[model samples]
Every structure is written in structure tokens, then in C-alpha cells.
Target: MIDLHGFGNQLLQGAVITVELAFASLIVGLILGLLGASAKLSSIKALQWIANAYTTIIRGIPELLTVLIIYFGATSVLMSVASLFGYEEYIEIGPFVAGVTALGLTFGAYATEVFRGALQSIPKGQHEAAVALGMGNVRKFYRIILPQVWRMALPGLGNLFLVLLKDTALVSVVGLDDIMRKASIAVSSTKEPFLFYSAAACMYLILTIISMVAVHYMEKKASRGIKRT
Candidate 1:
């Protein structure tokens, strides 16, 4: 057993923070993905353009750069807006919030494409059938469309989440006490860079494995009605 040398508790705390950051970003990403997909599918050209621009721009940027921009740039923008309002106090975004926002935006851009593709995969004939049956829009979506969409989108979404989980390490750059940061701290204290970094890598791998198992279970549940041909 490679001794953690009293850094075990702090590393565990960092792991907890990592989990929180990942889940928070996941929630934000899911909401944005849904909205983006809806906008892309809308008849309005403006909405489609806006959604397209958002996904394109965010996806184009580097993830670490995105975190830095959201963290520092947001503070600048917030401070500027506050100055306009005569509230000249310094504005700040916490490390956790910054991490979640950056990771969420990146995750959302990809998830938007995932959801859009999934929605498109659902046949138009099904929608026509639902309409012919006199089903309301909401009823049709809930009863006929959403379940299939979820089944189709879940795998891609799961993969995105795995990426997002890893990206939480980027938050450490912004001073969030996540696993990577904790490992850095341990290294600084113990002068054992290899041990701490190796530990962090194992922790990340453990998280990935757990997420994969959960995704597999969910996939099974979502595929309940499909005949295995």
C-alpha cells in the first residue's frame, strides 16, 4: 500500500468536490442541451442561427481557455455591469461555479448535437401517426417521442459525461480543490510528485469505471422494450 501520508482525508475531500462539480455541470449541460436542441429544431430561422452560433463558438474554444474565460472574464463583465448600476463592489465567480459553467457550456455544445441527431433519428412518420391519432403535442412527445429519444441519446450523453468528469480537472487551474489540485498539494508537501499524481490517476480511473457501469445499467433499462434481433 503506497502510504497517503496523512493526505488521504484531504484527497477524499477533493474527490467529493470533483463529483459535485461533475454532477453540477451535468445538470447545467442537460438543460442547455435540451434548449439548444429545441432551438435547432424550431421553424424560426433566428432561433436556429442562435443555437448554431452558440454550439459552434463554444465547441471551437479550448476547454481550459473556456474555464479561464468564464472565471476571469465573467468577473470583469459582472464588475462592468455593476459599475453601470453604481454598485462598484468587486465581482467574483467562485472556483466551483466557474468550473461548472465552463464544463457545462462545453458539454452542452456537444450534447446539443447529440440530442439534435437523436431527435432527427425519430421518424417523422411517427409524429404524423401521433397527429392522426388525435394526440396532443405534449402527449405525443411524452408518450411516443421522448422515450425513444432518451434511448437513442443516452449513450452519447454518457460519453459526454465521462469527458466532463475528466474535464473537472481543468477546474483545478482556477484554484478549485478538486482531485488534481489535491494531488498537487500533496506533491508539494511530500515532494513525491509521482506518488500523488499516480494516486490522482487511479482516482480518475475509478470514477470512470463507476460511471461506465452506471451508464450500462441505464442503457439496459432504457432498452427494455426493444427486441434483441
Candidate 2:
């Protein structure tokens, strides 16, 4: 065993950052995914085309490439603006922002398809009934469509979230000091790669277990009062 008492805190801190990144990305991703799905479902041809392209291109790209592109692209753009403003030094966007944006974009791409399919899975009769009962478009969507879509999308979203949690490890490539990067550092210092990596694995396993419990609770809550088909 390594001297975990003294040197383990760094790893713990990194793991915390990792979890925070995952949750933050998931939230942003969820919002973007819903918006993208709505755009895809819209009657506007251009909006639907744009949204479809976004999903297809993003889903096709490797996660690592996407992260690097977002990370470097964002910084480069900011730095350009800063230089024009007579600030010779670069305006820094930290690892957290880069990691969150990258991971969020990646998650959103997959989520767009999931949400679109879920929304489509809802019975058209529900919308028709709501309209017949004098519900406007907004009311119908919120009261009828949203509820059903959530129920249908929950499983797919949960699966995406689980994958998103694991992908937080990739942020380590950009020096985010997440669990994997910290584990690598620890291994270097202690010359115990297996021990540190195993610890990291344990942390990931714990996260998945907790997520499972939460997802199950949410599923039951969302499906409440709905009868079997």
C-alpha cells in the first residue's frame, strides 16, 4: 500500500473535480439536447436541417477530438479578441470551463437523438385531445407532451449520463486534474500504478452505483399514475 494518509488528498480532490465536471456537463447537455430536439421537430425546414447536422456531425466525431477542438478553439478565439483589445497576454479559460463545454457538447449530441425519438414516441392522440380541450400549443406541449417525453426519454438519458460520467476521465488529457490525471500523478510519485488506478476504478464504481439509485427513483417518480399499456 502507498502512503495514502499523506498523499491521498490530492487524488480525492481530483475525484471531486471529476464528479463536478460530470454533473455540470450533464445539466448543460440536457438543456442543449432539449433545445436541439425541439428545433429538429419544428416545422421550419432550416432549423430542422441545422439541428440534424449538429447531431450527426457531433455523434460521428470521436469524443477525444471533440474535446480537444472545443478546448483549443475556445481559447484561441478568446485570445484573438484579447490581443485586438491591446491585452498582449492571453485571456485564460480554465480547464474546468473547457472540460465542461467539451463534455457537455458531446453529451448533447447523443441526447438530441434520444429526446427527439422520445418526443416522437408520444401518441399523437394526446396532443389532439389537448387541442380539442382548448389547450394552446404551449399548454399542450408543457402539460401533455413534456410529461410523456420525460417518461419515454428517462432510460436513454440515464444511460447517456452514465456514459458521460465515465467520459469525464478524458478531460484529464487537457490537464483538468480529474480523477484519471490525478491517478497518473499519484502512480508516478508512489511508483504504484496498480494501486492508484485501482482506487480510481473504485471511485468510478461508486459513482455508477449512486447514479443507478437516483435514476431508479426518478423513473418511478416520472411514471407515477401511468397505467400499463
TM-score of each: 0.93, 0.90
- Residue-wise lDDT of candidate 1 within 97-165, one digit each (tens)? 989999999999999999999999998899999999999999998999989999999999999999999
Candidate 2 C-alpha lDDT tens digits along 31-146? 98999999999999999999989888888888888788878888888888888889888667677888888889888989999999999888888878998999999898898898
**Model 1 spans > 4 angstroms off:** 1-3, 79-92
Model 2 per-residue lDDT at 187: 83
Error of 1 at 39 (Å): 1.3
What candidate 2 gets wrong by more than 4 Å, as runs, is 1-5, 78-91
| TM-score result, candidate 1 | 0.93
RMSD of 1: 1.9
